[model samples]
Target: MTAREPRLLVVDDQALVRSGIVGLLEAAGLEVMGEASDGFEAIEQARRLRPEVVLMDIRMPGLDGIEATARLMAMPEPPRVLVLTTFDLDEYVYRALQVGASGFLLKDAPPDRLVDAVRTVARGEALLAPALTRRLIERYLAAPAPGVLAAPATELTPREREVWQLIAEGLSNHEIGARLYLSEATVKAHLTRLFVKLDVRDRVQAVVVAYESGLVRPGAQRATH
Candidate 1:
């Protein structure tokens, strides 16, 4: 039996960009569920299509992408959103994360990178590109939040805390598994535990807790994945 491809919704005002992304994603053997030309349409299509991932643009006509993303996330079972935009739209990257986007990507990301992003989101992993991840975090820190250490320290088990620290350092499940000499399933179990204990939706938010809670210090060298 053939494996079913993950369904994707490509949302961009630019027809060419949407088409190109759909083509790249489909060529990589994933399913393109639908396409939308604007944020309003994207939200409507996402509801109807029930895609696993929504490749969304930051700026769009009518409702902006950030608002659309926020609204979508409020759904009963929302799809993961990947902020895919051009270099000129980097300003919106931080806002996209604030709106609960699971990851960020360049519209010009290589074909493999785009494919990998779809797979990552389908697997319930955050799509934080290493470069964009740091940039988005720095933007948040520069403004300085009220330092809400929302994730309580005692809620995390000793093993779960170790996993959370590694996540803050940007380690993937496979890398964490290898480092701890545990199976990937064990690593994922720990991650799930951490997420529940912290009430976080993804690793991006977990990293925020790490910083706010002083679990991981800024400027500290993270383990290379």
Candidate 2:
């Protein structure tokens, strides 16, 4: 049987931008399940439609994308949220990642890139490369922020610590498996253990922890899968 297309919800405050994104996504053969003009509407639509991916714009009025991402992630079987932002350095993008967004896309990203972003997030992978994400986190860390501490990695086993460091290096599960001479399943298991031990919601957060704990450093070699 043919697989179902990924269902998506496009959220942006501007009517023209929302319409354009919806059109582009549909043109790429994705199912545009819904459109939300603001974050509150996004939550309501998400609750009702349960789309596979949410393309969220960050600067919406009342209930910004970061807050909405936090709320949606709290739901049972929440849809993956891919933040849409005008600026890569926008602090809210980092906050969105903290709130459990699967990843992010630039508002002006090309159509093909946008389609790929949606597909990437829908497939349960992060949209941003590890190195880029780490850079963003580094910027966030350089600036003073409350409640941004990385949870300690003291509980991690040595093997788990190795896996965490590799993850911080931006290796994918498959790459980590090959490097460690383990199966992909085993790598995923290691990541799961790290998440539970570190109390992080996703790999992005885990990488953040690695940086905050000094397990990984800026200008270190980044391996992109």
Q: What is candidate 1's TM-score against the reference?
A: 0.86
Q: Best-fitting candidate, measured by TM-score?
A: 2
Error of 1 at 157 (Å): 1.7
C-alpha lDDT of all candidate models, in order: 0.80, 0.85
Q: For this target, which candidate reaches the highest lDDT against the unseen true structure? A: 2
Question: Over the stretch 1-225, how does candidate 1's per-residue lDDT look in tens digits?
Answer: 965678899999999988988889888888898999988999899899899899899888898889999999999999999888776236577777766788788777789988988788778778775545655565565433444344476677888888887887778888889888999999988888888888778887777667667676566677765
Candidate 1 residues lying further than 4 Å off, grouped into runs, are 88-91, 142-148
How far residue 166's Cα lies from its native spot in candidate 2, in Å, is 0.9
Model 2: clashing residue pairs?
none
Models 1 onward score TM values of: 0.86, 0.86
